[model samples]
Target: MSCWDTIADYGLRSLGYGERLLPRSDFTLCQQVVLIGSGMLWNIYFGTLALIAGFVMATAVAMGKAARNPVIAKISAWFIFIFRGSPLFIQFFFAYFLFLSLKNAVPFFTVLTSAWAGALVVLFLNTAAYSGEIFYGALQSVPKGEAEAADAYGFGGWKKFRKITWPTMLRLAWPAYTNEAIFLFHATTLVFFSGFPAQSQRGDALYYANYFADKTFNPFVPYPVLAGYFILLTLVIIGLFGLINRRLNRHLPQERRSRMQMRMPVLR
Candidate 1:
């Protein structure tokens, strides 16, 4: 088949839209690229939904960690510790089986046994814990002078937090949060690799790349294509986050604004 035909046939195979059977022999470069790109739809699905849900949860978690009440503070702290302290791979392993058990007991949890739901819950909690810590640190680091200034203006409670505290906390936390967002997207590849099975052979980008590698007995081609797709994805993330970063710092002088620097974690 021509490249265009390959595109038409497999462009959305990962979503179960086009040809159901994967190419068995005489694999062409077009098939590899199109099928792999098709699989990226799942990566985008997991990452986008998890990140959006995590952002709201992370905000609540940060506030809980910083609350005046000891009970709330301790609960939040332990939540962060448990998720952050364990390896994510182990979390996925445990979560899948845990959900499976729940599914057996409660019919409502049947949906959670699937990778789409089960894997998403794992990613959502994981990113929320990490980001909650980041936001908590930023909350603490909010300049005391800013708080005092708010007090001077007779701002108190919700109004003060909304106008003064929250914006400043976001400004301070955004650079690090951008990094977390990037990492979250990268982590989506782990979904199918974990205990959660990809439904009906509709797997993510890494899943298809692994297939091609196993069939061709050549890791060099398909793996690199997968990497290339992720690299492009990373660039798109950086560009979009950079725009938000600039918006956050717009009120400040250029030199005084916090610039986003992408720093890879030494260990994660």
Candidate 2:
């Protein structure tokens, strides 16, 4: 088929549109690019939802870890320890089976065996733990002066946290959180490989790329294209996060504003 025809056929293939059957032989570059790009829809879907849900959950988790109440603190600490201590690949496998095992007892959980709900839940919780640690460390690092000032102004409890503490923690955490997001997006590639089956051949970019490589026994073409796609994806994430970082630190003087480094932050 012509390149345009190939594009048309596989462009939306990942979403169950156009060609249902992927190319079996004589794989073309256009076909690889088109199909893999289409498959990126899954990665974007998983990553976007996970990141959004994880952010809110992470905020709560950070607060829990920092709370004075021992029960809340221990619960949060255990959550962070469990998720952060374990490899995410293992988490996906364990979560899929755990969901499947409970499906009979909890009919609502039956859906968790699929990549849609099950995989999203795993990604959501996994990212939330990672992001929670970053936010927790940031919360602890919030300047002491700010806390005393809040007390002086009678800003106590949630008011102090809402008015002064939260913003500063976010400002400090933004850089590390950016890295966490990028990593989480990259982590989406692991779902199909873990226990979650891509029903209807609906999979992510890495899935299609892996298929092409396996079919042709040529890792050269498909893998590099996947890498390029991810590179572009990483750049876009950085750009979006950069905008947020600027806004987070916008109140600070220009000299005091910290520049975001591409490197990972020191989590401890």
Candidate 3:
């Protein structure tokens, strides 16, 4: 089959639309590319949904942290500390076990044992905490003059915060937010590792890459193909986030505003 045919046949195979069975023997580069590209859909799903959802939660956590109220501030602080202090790998393991135990304790908790529900929960919380910390620092640096300027314009409380404080915080927090976004994408590889079974042999890019490596006793081909796919994914993510960063910094001087630049990839 032509490469286009191979891709079309298996591109969305993870959702079970194409070839009924994966290539078992005589694994070719065509099979690997098609299957792994199909797996990329799952990575994009997890990363995009988690990051978009986490954006709001992170803002709330950061705003709560910067609030004058001690109780609200403390809760935000502790949540951020708890998630940030530990390795996400440990968190995923612990979360899986905790969900498993919860299922044992309460029969109604089976949903948490399902990877779709459980892994998303873990990632949602994890990214929220990390992004919250980034935003909190940015909020703190929003400048007293900006706050006073809000007051001078007869703005107070939520109005001042919603308009001035939030925008500025986002502007200052954006580069780091982009970092959090990329980190979250890398973290998507951990979904199957965290007790979330790949139902029906359906797995993410890494999971399939690992499978090929094991079956063929060849890591060189499969792993590097996975890497190339991920590099492409990363570039796309940067391009998307770069648009947002531009909008966020639109009002600032070019030299002072942060541009989205590639940095070290964060592997979970």
Q: Model 2: which ten-residue window has the lowest total lDDT?
A: 259-268
- Pairs of colliding residues, candidate 3: none
Residue-wise lDDT of candidate 3 within 78-137, one digit each (tens)? 999999999888888898889889998898778978777788888999999999988999
The TM-score of candidate 3 is 0.93
TM-score of each: 0.97, 0.96, 0.93
Model 1 per-residue lDDT tens digits across residues 1-268: 6999999999999988888899999999999999999999999999999999999999999999999999999999999999999989999999989988888889988898888898999999999999999999999999999999999999999999999998899998887888898888889999899899987789999999999999999999999999999999999998998998899889999899867877755425
Clashing pairs in 1: none
Please identify model 1 stretches exceeding 4 Å from their true place. none
Better TM-score candidate (2, 3): 2
Better by lDDT, candidate 3 or 2: 2
| Candidate 1 lDDT for residue 124 | 97
Clashing pairs in 2: none
Give the whole-model CA lDDT for all candidates, comma-separated.
Answer: 0.92, 0.92, 0.86
Give per-model CA RMSD: 1.1, 1.6, 1.9
